[model samples]
Target: MKLHALSPLERQDLIKQYAKSFSERAKQHDEEQSFPFENIEELKMIGYTSLSLPKTLGGQGIPLTEWLKLQELIATADGSTSLSIGWHMGIVSELNQKNWPDSVLTHVTKKISQNGFLLNTAATEPDTGSPTRGGKPTTQAKKVGSDWVLSGRKSFTSMVPALDFILVSASMDDDQVGYFLIEKGASGVRVEETWNTIAMRGTASHDLILENVKIPHDHLVELVVPGKKSPSGWLLHIPACYLGIAQAAQTEAVSFASTYSPNSLPGPIKDIPAVQSKIGENEADLIQARYLLYGVSAKWDAATDEERLEMQSELGVAKYHVVNAAQKIVDRAMRVVGAQSLFTSNPLQRYYRDVRAGLHNPPMDDRTLVLLAQSLFN
Candidate 1:
């Protein structure tokens, strides 16, 4: 079916309908640290895998804002699956927005639509940390005749096993930064199973090593001109992922509170005023976070390129409010559930771990606060 032809409400309904099965698949995937092939296949069958492809490419062309909302809904059901697929969706959406050459876009879109292909950004370097700094990439890509040879190591490549292509940021000989599309199974490219983390354990964010991997010139996306500011929307992906985690936390909290009863409590925990109050607080925080995210996203959609560049501080505010508040909301949910929240079988325990990952995401708390202060002061 042509999902792109559907109205916003229809698309939302379609996603909701599929979420039940996806949630079951996610639970299994999370426990085994396995890729959610079943869930992904379901997404492919429903045309969700090709949601971001351009209409010209024979695929649905969903807007990024709509895409983010859909992601939030899916995340509310299963965070690990959502987190895994959301990264791929974001990269695909961004590439579509870039309006690459028709041939390049068509080729990638065909792969995605037909095979449920996935792409991820491999930008995090071990030495320099987050790619937000726009630091000089330790990875180097040099012109070797017709092809560019890329040699570097990238850490925190989320959803490595499922990736079909990776956008690797590298420094050119002229000291310019550029993105190169490195295809899977490319010679000299190896994935190291190094993702040992406390949260998002199912994400498979392993380290990728490239040793003289060759990429065609057309694979290069854009050259990052020196002194140019980074785009604000790029940071939105981090918050988007966290928003999903937060919504999941809220869902689990409400479900548990409504059904679970303690020995001391007369009825379900939901009947307890204190538990109810905690649920209320968590709901309020989630609502606040959602508003901040959608509000900023609306502004972003309406913003011109220049206008968006100037709204760096506002973007930071959105990220800061949503991510930090969502963390607190999840914590409150855990408190409402009491000791049961810590059980391995309880989804709340996973929510706790997943939500904390946002703390380290870009637009770090200190940076956002500093930016806010600078915007208000001098």
Candidate 2:
């Protein structure tokens, strides 16, 4: 059945079914440090990858809140898969909402619908750090005849293995940042296996090495003044991923507590007051985080462009509180499980490492504080 024809609840149930299947292989993927290529294929087969595209482009046109729910389910199964695909979903949604050239937007979306192509931005670098921090990209783009040639190395190019097109940011001669769309496997474009992080190992967030990669003149999709762009509500996917991991952690802890009776105990630890307290705490934190996350996301869906421009602070605050709460919940879950939570075989250990990576995502805690402080002054 077509995804758009299904009710929201039905669509969500379909996704949950797939997420359960993903969970079965999540441990193997994490342990082997291998990307879940089959998962992406399944998502495509079920039309999950194109759910965020505009309905005019033959997509589900899922609103922000519903889209985040899908992401959260995937993350609960495997953070690496969720994060890797989240970039693709968010970028597509953002571009479709923006005033990008219709030609470029139509072309890309068409490719996504027809060929199951994927897209993501390659923005981070070794020296400049996150593009959100306002450091100009050292990667340069020059007018070479009828086309532009780009040369730079981008770090943390997530999902490069499966991406069909990469949106690369480059410093133009005019002192503005230009985002160019380059197809994968272009001459001089290679992925370096540089991702060796302790968490989210299956994301394949390696280094993208571009040595004089050339693209058509029209491929320079957008030119923006660095640090002057509007807020992207689509970034809520980052927090949603963490929230899913947190929820998974809580579930695992509770399951363990509900069983595993010790010789000194009359029954499972879940009946113990101390363990119950931890479970209650996790539930409380998740309730608050879920409310804030879903509330802001719904507001974004109903907001006008001008109104959204004013929501930067609220967006950052949601991300800040939710991600931090996710970390806290994961920590408490581990405590409930005791030393066994740290065992390599335990999924709680994977959840612990995966949730920590959220702090390093965009709109970090320090940046969120600054946004809050500036809001008060305004």
Candidate 3:
């Protein structure tokens, strides 16, 4: 009956149990560009929404290593679903680690654990691109009589239609930038369907527009203080998600090689040294990527304040290497599968597309390289 306090393997097996169903319907959701609400519900029923919360709060409170491995397994089942929910998982976990206000943390943890609520932050604007680029948001929040009127358009709002709590970044009249949490059904809030893309179609990432939306004064979560940005463990969730997707691709490649046999060949291609070599290559890189993610995550979990202060670029390196290697693993799998990998119905085809999305996630490759270079001198 109890899910927490279990061995890591036991917790992973439980998470994988739900992943199977998500894997089964992945293609359908992708084809229709529909949100996998059912997949999220299953995770909710399993108490996954609270996995990162502390046990004192009636949550699972899993560590970074185990949480990431579970994320990889879930990504294996469905990358879209994994990525969509990663926002919620990462934010809750990161908030728990911070000395930030309890108003936001208590409200979020209770809603997620008790009501199965989901969270996503909307910061990207059409003109400025990724929020990590240091540009002030165009979305403006004007102070009113004990309320803030938020007006802005957030592009690439992942899990838009399904989010229970939407965190919107806005530039206040006082020239301060902060994130405001908007609950579902808020007045003057609307989602414009606009998430048509070649990859990760099931993410339901659309444009969220706020026209004079009103919220309480406390809704502004935190203001960004330049040169004082705190390091976050939640961002690691992105790399972990990609690693899971790549693992899925590897699984499909190995299974395909062991089963398919050309009439001209004596047996399955898995027997041929060439095919074996390809799978071997993927396996080796996958191991590297997996270990890198786990090792860094473990280090982060154990790091004290002084150690954490030095991890700025280390975290980016983890994301860059893992995501790039993950993309490569999926590509190698496609090579093992040959031209058939291109078929619309082939999982490898989908894997290739999905894995590429990681390249565009936060801490982009170029930025990672820049960070690495800067860290060397400092």
Candidate 4:
């Protein structure tokens, strides 16, 4: 189960198989705003969902580098599904890095590997807005002897319908921040029908309300601080999701160009130099993004804690370049596809909407630029 247990080629093959299944269910999942239960089942059977868990815990022990590559492939096939599951995988990776109690790790990994569990963070709040501001959580978790009573509303809780556990951020004494693992069947915990969004609709990112919900003491994930410096590698997830969406748009564009021929054109649209130029640009952008992401990740993997902290500026640079380029790439793909790209039935329309969502994710354009500016000047 250790990362060493699987050869590099085997890992690649495993991801290839998962991507195939993801492609098959993507359209239906997007259309219905439904979870990809079949895809999850397939992943569980193949141990793809448990790749980040330690080998000692009866799970595949894949390295972070290899894991991100697999994520890119999965996202390319289906961005929403990849986004939903990527968070869970990230939690697993973080938990492993924290080196939790062996018993706790074993229990979580076994369940996830067996049943394909999903975990999502409930950190965003409507009033507080961005988590970077170190928002004072409205949700409060009060210690009641051996249990903690949680109460408050959490919005933008992605993959709620299929989530096995939610890592909710709450304030103790109404000032101190803490995280708790809230289960699906916990009393006083309810899911609100409030997930109508412009993109990533299949995520089912609804509201979670906990009114006097009780969680065990062991379920708490304590942190020394409210918002610690995020590792640069985390930003790669955003780019991976957007890059996948851009690739999807490119695929649609290529298909359209191959078949569609306008009355003014002599041959297929693909034969047109203008259309070819746009495709080439998209390809170059995607390639650049991938290279920057991988290069940054490699440095992060080998960096010391102090070095990693100092590289925050570099992290912003990667997110800024990749996400922005991906947006432009997707836009060009839409343009090459013509007016049909705007139709609801066309995948390009969905890609157009989804690609924009990356702009609003963490490391926002303004913040990224500010960080880079400070690094350069100060």
Top candidate on lDDT is 2
Q: Write candidate 1's Cα lDDT for 1-378 as tens digits.
A: 546668998988888888887676665666777766676677777778778665656557676678878877787777666777877776676565574556666777789878778878888899878777556789999999988999999998988887888889899998789888888899999999898787777788899999999888888877774234555564565677778777778778888888887789788878888888888887888788878888887888788877877878877887788888878888998998789899888887877888888888777889878777877788
Q: What is the lDDT of residue 376 in candidate 2?
A: 79
Q: In model 4, where do residues sit more than 4 Å from their true spots?
A: 1-6, 56-58, 99-103
Clashing pairs counted in every model: 0, 0, 0, 0
Query: What does candidate 4's lDDT look like per residue over 10-79, in tens digits?
Result: 7777677678878777777777777677766666666677787666665575666677777777777777
Predict model 3's lDDT versus the native. 0.85
Query: Rank order by lDDT, top first?
Result: 2, 3, 1, 4
Tell me the tens digit of each residue's lDDT in model 3 across 194-256. 999978998999999999999998888778842346667668888998888888888889999
Which residue ranges in model 3 land beyond 4 Å of their true spot? 56-58, 97-104, 226-228
lDDT (Cα) of model 2: 0.89
TM-score of each: 0.91, 0.97, 0.95, 0.91
Q: Model 1 misses residue 66 by how many Å?
A: 1.5
Model 2 lDDT per residue over 1-378, tens place? 545567889988888888887898888988888889989988887777788887787566789899899899899988989999999988887665656678887888898877778999999999899888888999999999999999999999999899999999999998889899999789989999999988999999999999999888889988876666688988999999999999999999889999879999999998999999999999999999999999999999999989999899888989999999999999999999999999998999999999999999988899889878877798
The true-versus-predicted C-alpha distance at residue 341 of model 2, in Å, is 0.5
Is 1 or 3 the stronger prediction by TM-score? 3
